[model samples]
Each structure stands twice: as structure tokens, then as C-alpha cells.
Target: MQYKLPVSVLVVIYTLDFEVLLLERADHPGSWQSVTGSQDEGESLRETAVREVFEETGLDANHYGLVDWQVQNIYEIYAKWQHRYAPGTRHNTEHVFGLELPCVLPVQLSPREHLSYKWLPWQEAAGLVFSPSNREAILQLPAREKARG
Candidate 1:
């Protein structure tokens, strides 16, 4: 089996009105997060974001307003999930991106990965996410897109 790379992307998908999308993990029921996945060899960060968003939520990030947040977070891999990475891999560097939509929309979740999806107010979404970085990113969404208006 191929071990995952240490680099990954965390995409905060939100609507113009700040309804953020969160998905419940199939592996960890009730634990929710935004779109995320590791970078494949030969893929740029934007490419990773687009691929992951589509794979996780059936959304073509390219068709919407996708933007790099120009920020990243480095955090230790959870003990429960560290096995997916190479032995001795302890942390991951997550590049941040934002995908904007007109409003909350239906999502097609991958049953093997995610169990359910929901669009919540940014603040509520932030509180509901299991990852600190994902939560913080959600909390910052409104400010990050303030000028987009």
C-alpha cells in the first residue's frame, strides 16, 4: 500500500453568505471537517485542492471561486491516523485554500470516506470541526473574503 505524503491541503468551502461545508468522517463518526487530502506526486497545491474537493464532495473547485489563502499550518498527525503516513511521519503541512459558492448546495459524499455533509454558519462550522486548523480556518473565512464583496 502507498503511504501518504506529509504534505496536504485543507480547503474551506463556503458560500457568499458564509455557510461553510463540513463533512463527517466515515472512519470517525461525528467528527467533521472541510475538504482535505494529501498531495500526489507531480501535482501542484491548487491541483491537489481541486482533486480533493472533487473526490470528497463531488464539487469542481475550478468551476467556482477558488483561492489560495497564502497560509499553512503544521500539525502532528493524530495517533489514530498516523499509520496512513510513512513510518516516523509525525506531522503534516496543510496548505489552506478557500472555495466560494453562491449559496449552500447539495454535496455527493464518498461513502468510503465521508458519511455526511452539511452547510453551517461559519462560526458554527468552526466549532463543529474536529481539527484545530480546520476550525481556525473556518473562523477566519468571513474576514478573508470580506473584500470579495
Candidate 2:
């Protein structure tokens, strides 16, 4: 079995107006989040972000504003998902990114990875994400946008 790399990317896809796109997990229904995935060997974090966004939402990230937030979070892998990494690998490092779209657009989710998708106000989206890191990223959207501008 191929074990996943211990590095990943978390991409918060949102609009200039603060509407965020979230995907409901297929494996764990009701758990909604932005585009996220583990990095493959030889892939940079930015590449991981773009690939994950495409895989999860069918959005061409390059056509929009994809920014690496220059933030990293090291966290314990969820107990149920630890097996996806090498044996005894309990932690993963996740790089943060943001994909700024002009507006909310329909998404085609990878059925195996996500069950559904939605566009919600940043606050509501932040409140609904299952991961604290994801929530924090969404919460920072306003400040991040201001800084970008």
C-alpha cells in the first residue's frame, strides 16, 4: 500500500465579497471544509493546493487568484485517518492557501472525496467547518483580504 506524504495543503476558496466555498466530506458526511489534500512526493505545496482545488471543486485555480498564505500548521492526524500515512506517523504539516474568485461559482465535486458543495458567508462557513484549523483560516479571510488589498 502507498502511504500518503505527511505534508498537505488547506485551501480556503472564497470570493472578494467574503463568500466561501465548502465541500461536505463523502467519507464523513456533514463534515464540510474547503479544498484540502495530502501532497504527493515531489509536489510543492502550491501545486498541491491547485491540484486539490481542481480535484475537489473543478475550479481552475490558476485562472483566479491563488495565494499561499505563508502559514503552516502542524497537527495530529485524526485517529481514524492515521492509517493513510506511514505506520506510526501521527502528525502532518498543513500549508495554508487562499483562492480568490471573482464570485461564487458552481462546483463539480469529486464524488468519492466530497458529497456536496455550498457557498456561504464567511462567518457561516467558518462556523460549519469541522476542523478548527479550517475554521481559523475562514475566520481570517477578512483580515487577509484587507492585507492583500
Candidate 3:
């Protein structure tokens, strides 16, 4: 089996009105997170975000306004999921990005990766994610949106 990389991307999919799309992990049961995935060997971080969003949800990331937030979260990998990475890989560096859609769109979840999906107001979605980095990224959305406006 190909062990996963220690680098990943977190793509927060949302609309201009502040609704965020979250996905529940199939492997972790109740763990909900934004569209995320590990980086492939030769891909750029933005590529990872685009690919992950498409893989986890059905959205074509580039078709919308996909912005790299210029933020990185360096955190310890959760014990339960550490085996997916190389041995001794205790930490992961996650790059954050945001995909601003026109509005809520239909989502197609990959059954193996996600159990289900939901679109919630940014605040509620921030409260629902399992990862601290994921939650923090979601929580920052409102301020970022305000700054962009």
C-alpha cells in the first residue's frame, strides 16, 4: 500500500452568503470536516485542493473563485489516522484554501471517503468540524469575507 504524505490541503467550500459545505468522514463515522485530502507526490498545494474538492465533493474547484488563504496549520496527526502516513510521521502541514461558489450546489459524495454531506451557515459548520485546524479555518470565514468586501 502506498503510504500517504504528511502534507495536505483543507478546502473550505462556501457561498457568498456564508453557507459552508461540510462532509462527514466515512472512516471516522461522526467526524465532520471540510473537503480535505493528502497531497500527491508531484502536485502543488493548489492542485491538491482542487483535486480533493473534486474527489470529496463533486465541485469543480477552478470553475469558482478558488482562493489560497495563505494560511497553514501545522498540527499533530490524530492517532487514529497516523497509520496512513509513513512511520514516525507524527505531524502534518495543512494548507488552507477557500472556494466561493455562487450559491449552494448539489454535492456528490464519494461513498468511500464521506458518509454524507451538509450545507450549514458558516458559524454552525465551524462548530461541527472534528479537526481543530478545520474548525478554525471555518471560523475565520466571516472575518475573511468581511475583509474581502
- The Cα error of candidate 3 at residue 45, in Å, is 0.6
TM-score of each predicted structure versus truth: 0.96, 0.98, 0.97
Top TM-score model: 2
The C-alpha local distance difference test score for the whole of candidate 1 amounts to 0.93
Cα lDDT of model 2 by residue, 2-114, tens digit: 99999999999999899999999999999999899999999988888989999888989999999999999999999999889899899999999999999889999999999
Highest-lDDT candidate: 2
Best-to-worst lDDT order: 2, 1, 3
RMSD for each of the candidates: 1.0, 0.6, 0.8
Candidate with the larger TM-score of 2 and 3: 2
Query: What are the lDDT figures for the candidates, one per model?
Result: 0.93, 0.93, 0.92
Residue pairs with clashing backbones, model 2:
none
Candidate 1 global TM-score: 0.96
Can you write out model 1's per-residue Cα lDDT over 1-149, one digit (the tens) per residue? 89999999999999988999999999999999999999998999999999999999898998999999989999999998888999999999999999999988899999999999988999899989989999899988777777665
